[model samples]
Target: MSLHSMGLELVETVIYLTNTLICVILAVLVTDAWFRGDHKGSLLYWMIAAWVMFAADVLFASRPLLSPVVARILPTLLVTVGQAILLIGARVNSGQTKVTLVEPIGAVVLHAVLLTVFHFLAPESPLRRVSNGLIWATLAYLSYRGLRQSPPVFWRSYTAPAKAFMAHAIFHLVRTVLVLLPLSSTSEALNTFVAILGDLEVSFFMVALFVGLLLAHLKQRNEQLSSALAEVKTLSGLLPICAWCKKVRDDDGYWQQVDHYFRNHSKIRFSHGMCTDCADDFRKEAEKLQPSDL
Candidate 1:
């Protein structure tokens, strides 16, 4: 291999290494959140999609030793499925009701068929040029839709994820251009520079991801602190109580259910199923309902 190729290889290796580190950190956070049920607040499949893309990057970067067919096919399949899932997640999270699965799957399958044909019929040519275009086109379209129709909470509380999605789409678009553009012999310096710049882009993605997670963590912590502060109270003696109902009257002067009043006046939430009497009443009511409805 020439020095330029060697340099490219080294740079690619470093880029993949950085992605691997990011994957590890993301995996840890994802795993913990998944187990603890904290990620229930967000789209689980979208996070999985990011991990799949990370896997694809690792696979593609190892193409020198691994079979070229496997490298190409693996990333292509992953990028397709991952991006599709991510798009779906973004739509759902943003409260869009209409999403058709067939379009993305069909596009991916068609591209795979074309790529497989080209790999066998014209092995000398790189087919990723066309594949990248399709993927990026989809990404751009979805990113636009997501940004345009995003929820208020998505914009206010968790804006980073939205921005990350858009930024990712933009990067994929740039990748499409890089893959599609022809390289000239006279542009060797430019090619080298672009290669290094591409490596830097990967670094930028990692840093962005790290910053996103940090923001998420801080946002969560701030919310918790706010809640704690909101619930803190300085109570005085001889609080007003309802004479007949035995319910406490708060400073707001509203008569409330014992549990409801406590929950409103304090920080805790109620748990457990209905009591025996309530359960019995519910069963009797159910029995009285129409058989078809039941």
Candidate 2:
């Protein structure tokens, strides 16, 4: 390769490597959150997507050592699959437990088809360089649709992930379309700027998605904890008590006196009052005990 081409390749590789490292770190953090929260569903799927994305970047940067077809197909395939999986998780986040895989699978097929056709028909075309954007945009649109339909979370940002994803998709689609124009095709400087902007945009998109996922799960967990607390406030049946000591055994196995337990656990308050039988017994004893006898 010429020196200029070599330098460009080096820059791209460096960017990919940095992105890969970021992806790995984010994946680890997500996995840790998954375990800490005992989370499943979308969080698990998003974690898997993070690893897949980093793997895609690895394959993309290692293109120099890969076979021609393997280099092209594998990286693209992984990208498609990773995004599709992310969409699946997004749907789950929206409470669509039975979300169909049809859209995601169709997107993968479209990505493969687009890449294959462009590789054969116009391998060196500038438009082909950004053509994968079409498939990504499709997935993004699907994700936006899924997430926008989600019930509004009280403390969470509404459709933030949906918007971040859609923004990237729009950027890519617009760039791809612009490349088809004669002015865009001929302007080397503009193309270079687009490439740099694309990298930055991708980084931002990744970070936003990660943050969105984290916030979404945290909101869910907080809501769950709030519900539990509400339930606790409403004291229920079956308190374990020592009959003689009148101490209640809490779930933590700590013993608390009747008045203390009620005060701590419920809205009920203590009153120094005796029952009818106890009052009657006290009166009888009082009458039997004469002040003169003392």
Candidate 3:
């Protein structure tokens, strides 16, 4: 091979390695959060998706070791499924009405099957590229939808995930249009350009995913800390209490029952119960009580 071609190959490999590292690092970060816990274990899906994308990168790099068919199809399969999994995580985290898991899963499977069929028929066709690009754009759109439509506590409208999704969607759409254009004279150049652009996309996607998801987790964690602080602040200071009535004074300067005070200030709720001393005293009182007193 010419030195120029060799240099390009080296650069491509480096980009793939960089993308792989991003996926692995993201997988580890999300795994920590997943184990620590989030609402509905949503981070579990994110962790899995990160690892899946990592696997895709590994598989693509190991193409020489894989059967031609597997090498061609598996990486794409992983990419599509990873996107679906992210959407699922957002849906789970948001506690939104679910889109039956089968729908998304089935769409991915069917797409994979179609790709496989096309691979056997005319793998190099522009139609395949167009189809692939559109599906990727669609999945990215759905992922954005999942995030934007999530419950207020889970995600804000203006967030990294939203931007990531929009970027991916637009990138794929532009790529599709470029491929669809009948530029016969530039076909070879177009192919080379597309290959380089695709490698860059891989790098950008991994970084975007890592940063976006990391920011998302951090945002959630900050919200939680803020909430805890708010609760603590509410009950922090010395409160004026009625020693005789046992009522606590609230910020409004109105006396309220202890249960009401705690409930309003924090998550605490009262289930009325008697302690051992109180129970014993009550029993004694009952024993000493006459029928008229009762």
Candidate 4:
């Protein structure tokens, strides 16, 4: 059957549009995170770049046959560059602890340049295979960096979002392999794999982006809870005690100045007053004592 008659065109169109929308969502999330103080610097740039590449992919797929080779190659280049930027940005945002910016960027640039050259040198051969392998390898490296650099608190707090991004990366890598394999012999199998991968990729990215947005808010809630708990820990209450000492020690520590300690440690307010017993004791003590005891 002819290409249009084979029913693949509609599927491809849908996949392209879905991925484009996912990328847009990711862009908005990255921007929001930067504004909310969760992320900064190169990561934001790379996300924006990825969004642009997704747009280009949408435009290219709209008229795939009519699009020029440069049109295709340019977006691939942007993807390569953006991936490197993201690697660097991860290091920067992570406080230079877990990710190393220089080495990863250098590796991505080297591999991408080699792949571009291979595309021209051996368009219809295994050199392209090697190039595709490099792409997956680079993605694996970046994923590793992202996982390693994220703090334990960040991990426990945002595990689902992290998994979403990792799953999306895996889907992209699988799709890359699918594209690299010779498709003439196993067209049906390959087409099914492509559709599945496309759906996974779109869902993974879109969900991850939204989850990331909510993650910052979740962290804020956690902070507020912690603050409130601390406030409750050292609060004091009115407890009957000996009036001779003029000091109060609760279940915790020996409080030197009850009013000062409570004011310092908790939200309790105090008013100075003497109880009936203390007032009567003071009055009787005064009556027994003469004006000049000597």
Candidate 5:
């Protein structure tokens, strides 16, 4: 091979290796999160999506060893299905939607059918690329919508992931448009550049997404801990109670019934009832008062 050809090959190898490394790291991070009790349905879906993408990357990198039909269909199917699942995961994570198998399953089936039909009709044509890109863009838009619909407190946490999905969508849409344009030396170079840029973009986005999710979970946990601590502190200080009346002294130096004090200071509510000894004494007093019961 010429020096230029050799250099291009080396660059391609490096890019593929880097992509593989990032996907593996992301998979590990997500798996750890799930084990650490981030076991939401959305998280599970996201993990599956990551693995599917990883598999697609691996298959593509080994494409030279595979037959033509397998080479085209497998990777495309993996990517399309993975994107669909990722969208569902985002929606579920946002707490705005419940997890349903229908969407992800249907998405996978639809992509598979479209890819199969297109392969027969026009193998590796602009039409195929356009269809693939539109499918991905649609899924990305749905994921972005889910993030946008998140509650205010959580929306901040989703910002990075949302941006990542948006960037992916835009990139694919541009690629689709580029495919439709007449091919030239310049356009070919641009397409190659876009492909390289996509790899780098995906790597950065995965790391950012992992960090964002971890921070979001930590923030939520910290808030819960702080609230619990405040409750403990509220009930912990010296509670001065009258030796005889059972009334408690308030912070304002006023005595109030124990039940009233607790009700005001905390969430405790009281039900009026006499103890066994008090109930017996009340019965004796009632019998004494009923003198004319001959």
Candidate 6:
């Protein structure tokens, strides 16, 4: 191969290997999320998205074995559908959306139909490239928006993922614009450079995104545990109770009724009723006190 051809082959090899590695990492993350038993749906969808993108890379790399139409359309279709699903997953994780089978299933069907129409009706047209890019860009934008709008308690944790999604969206938008540019050797070279840069950005941000998600979930859980501990500590230590009154002394050295103490320290509620023994004792004491003592 010529020097130029060899350089291109090296770049393609690197992209392929990187994508394969990402797919493996994503699979492992998904498994970890499943074992953790939190955010499984979101993690599973993210994993599926990664697998779809990896499959697209595989298909594109094997273009030599495919017919012209299949080679032209299949990879792009996979990528479009993958991005849409990724957005849905991100939204669900951010609590801005809910998981449903219909959206992802519909996205797959829509991508396939669009690619089929583009292949037969307008082969090699900029419309096909533009449409694909636009769809991916839109989904990325939506994901960014959802992450940004996460609840305040979770907003800090989601910051990194939101920024990553924003970066991803920007890259796709740039790609869409590049697709609409006039074709020339110079433009093609620039487009190729942009495509490789976009891929690298995606790889970096995906790693950050998943790690951020895991950290955010752990942080939320930690906060919950801390709150529970604080509550438990409130009722701990030496609580002084009056020998005769049965009232408990609080941290401030103020005596409070037993029912009030428990209600303040915990979620316990009291029913105002004397026990049978206490009721009997009260009755006997009343009988002994009699009206004659007055």
Top model by TM-score, which number?
A: 3
Q: How do the residues 126-176 of candidate 2 rate in per-residue lDDT, one tens digit apiece?
A: 855666777788787788777777755412364467777777678878877
- Local distance difference test values of all predictions, in order: 0.63, 0.79, 0.79, 0.59, 0.74, 0.72
Clashes of 3: 0
Question: Candidates 1 and 5: which is better by TM-score?
Answer: 5
Question: What is candidate 5's lDDT per residue for 1-294, written digit by digit as tens?
Answer: 778656765776676677777788788877777778747656687778778878877876776688988887998798877788787777787775455667667777888888888888877456776777788888887777776665443445445567667777887888777777777224657666655665566566666655555565666678878988888888997999999999999989999999988888777899998899999998888888855873
lDDT of 6 by residue, 168-236 (tens): 677778877776666622465776675677667656766766666666666767888998899898888
**Stronger candidate by lDDT (1 vs 3):** 3
Task: Give one digit per residue, the lDDT tens place, for model 3 in 245-268.
Answer: 999888888999999989888999
Instruction: Pick the winner on TM-score between candidates 4 and 5.
Output: 5
Report clash pairs, candidate 5.
none
Q: With candidate 3 superimposed using the best TM-score fit, by how many Å does residue 228's alpha carbon deviate from the native?
A: 1.0
| Candidate 1 clash pair list | none
Better of 3 and 4 by lDDT: 3
Candidates sorted on lDDT, descending: 2, 3, 5, 6, 1, 4
> Per-residue error at 26 for model 3, in Å?
2.8
Say which prediction, candidate 2 or candidate 4, comes out ahead on lDDT: 2
TM-score of each: 0.64, 0.74, 0.84, 0.60, 0.75, 0.72
Residue 168, candidate 3: C-alpha displacement in angstroms: 1.0
Any idea how many clashes model 4 has?
0
Poorest stretch of ten by lDDT in candidate 6: 151-160
| TM-score for predicted model 2 compared with the true structure | 0.74
lDDT of 2 at 89: 82
| Inter-residue clash pairs, candidate 4 | none
User: In the order shown, what is each candidate's alpha-carbon RMSD?
Assistant: 7.8, 11.2, 3.3, 9.8, 4.5, 5.5
Compose the digit string of candidate 1's lDDT tens values, residues 1-294.
998789888877777777667766765666565566556533475467667767877775687778878865666676676667666665665665675566567766876786687677875443445465556567646744663465433334444655655676677677656655676224666656655665566556545543554455456567777877766643335667778988887777887766776676676677867899999999999989998896
